[model samples]
Target: MEKFTTLTGVAAPLPIVNVDTDMIIPKQFLKTIKRTGLGTSLFYEQRYHEDGSENPDFVLNQPAYRDAKILVAGDNFGCGSSREHAPWALKDFGITCVISTSFADIFYNNCFKNGILPIIVSAEELEKLLDDASRGANATLTVDLERQEIKGPDGGTIRFDIDPFRKHCLINGLDDIGLTMQKAEAIAGFEGRMGEARPWV
Candidate 1:
């Protein structure tokens, strides 16, 4: 996972609620375990129409939001099914942070693991961010992981809360495997000691 220290980029506005994992990547796109190519298929059903043509109405299809690094969505974001791929697709699509009034617990946890920051805030604050995001190409937002703050395009700042341990992991680009690797020397020493003590086995 890439480190997420500070990110400043255009924010896409997605006001719809209950954006589930399947809506994000769709069931057909789940064949690959790899995370790299999933971005193209992110929001497959919503981004493309029945004939596979691009949907002009979707926020992501708009030129201003095509490269958006943040997403300001409605309440109950990421509300269904537990698929890690949701965050993978979001990251691949260039979204580093997601701001919403609320998020499903599992999806919120998965975001950190995949190097995506899922921010929970009040409904009024979310609306402010969403409006700021609707400012076309100027819908830029700044996210400071170390400070746990989000600066809207209007220059207003919003504070968010994250677990300190998770914050450390994201700041240093440490995933579960990365965390284990942090104790490599100790693990190796313990294994060697075990082998020496049970050499007959």
Candidate 2:
């Protein structure tokens, strides 16, 4: 996973509620376990029509938001099955941070593991973010993980809370495997001792 320290980029506004994992990547795109190519299929149903044409009405298809690195969405974002691919697709699509009024617990946790920052803010704050995101190409937002702050284009700042441990992991680019690798020496030593102590077994 890539490290997520500070990210400043255009924020795309997605004001829909209950955006589940299926709506994110769709069931059709789940065949591959690899994460790299999933970005093209992100929001497959909403972003593309049945004929496989790009939906002009979709926020991601709009020219201004095509490269958006941040997403300001409505309440209850990421609320469905716990597929880790959701975050993988979002990350691959260049979304480094997701700001919403609320998020499903499992999806929220999945974001950190995949190097995406899922932010929870008050309803009032979300409205402010939505307003900022409505600025089209100018909807740039700066997220400072170290400071736990989101600075909007107009100079307004919003503070968000995050678990310290998760914060540490993201800053250090440590995924689950990366975290375990931190104790490689200890693990190796334990394995060596066990082999010597119970060689017959």
Candidate 3:
């Protein structure tokens, strides 16, 4: 996982609610365990038509949002199955931050593990962010994790809260594997002691 101290980029508005895992990456794209290549398939159904052509109507496919790094979505985002691929797809698509009024617990947790910031704000706050995102190519927002603040295009700021531990993990680029590696010396010492005491076994 990459460290996420601060990010500044365009925010695309996705005002739909109840966006589930399947709607994000679709079941057909789930066979691969690798994280790469999913970006093209993110929101596959909504981004493509029956003939596999790009859907011009989807927010992601629009000219201004094709490279959006943040997403401002409606309430109840990521509300279905606990598929970890949803966050994978989002991160792969260059969206490292997601701002919504609320999110599903599983999806929210998955975002942090994958180096994505999932922000929860009041409904009123979301409306403000959404309004900023509606500005096409000018929907830039800056997310500063250290300050727990989001700076909008018009110089407005919104403060958010996050667990201190999760903030540390993201700041240091520490995933579960990375966290375990931090204890490598201790783990090695314990294994060496166990081996000496149980040589017969």
Each model's lDDT: 0.91, 0.94, 0.95
* Backbone clash numbers for all candidates listed: 0, 0, 0
| Deviation in Å, model 1, residue 14 alpha carbon | 0.3
lDDT of 2 by residue, 36-100 (tens): 99999999988989999999999999999999999999899999999989999999999989999
Writing each residue's lDDT as its tens digit, candidate 1 over 1-201 gives: 789999999999999898888888888887889989999999999999999999999999999889999999888888888988899999999898999988999999999999999988898888899889989999999999999999987789999998999999999999999999999999999989989999986
Between 1 and 2, whose lDDT is larger? 2
TM-score of model number 2: 0.98
Off by over 4 Å in 3: none
Q: TM-score of every model?
A: 0.97, 0.98, 0.98
Clashing residue pairs for model 3: none
Instruction: List candidate 2 segments past 4 Å from native.
Output: none
lDDT digits (tens) for residues 1-201 of candidate 3:
899999999999999999888999899988999999899999999999999999999999999999999999989899999999999999999999999999999999999999999999999999999999999999999999999999999999999999999999999999999999999999999989989999776
Q: What lDDT is obtained when candidate 2 is compared to the true structure? A: 0.94
Query: Which ranking of candidates, highest lDDT first?
Result: 3, 2, 1
* RMSD list, candidates in order: 1.0, 0.8, 0.8
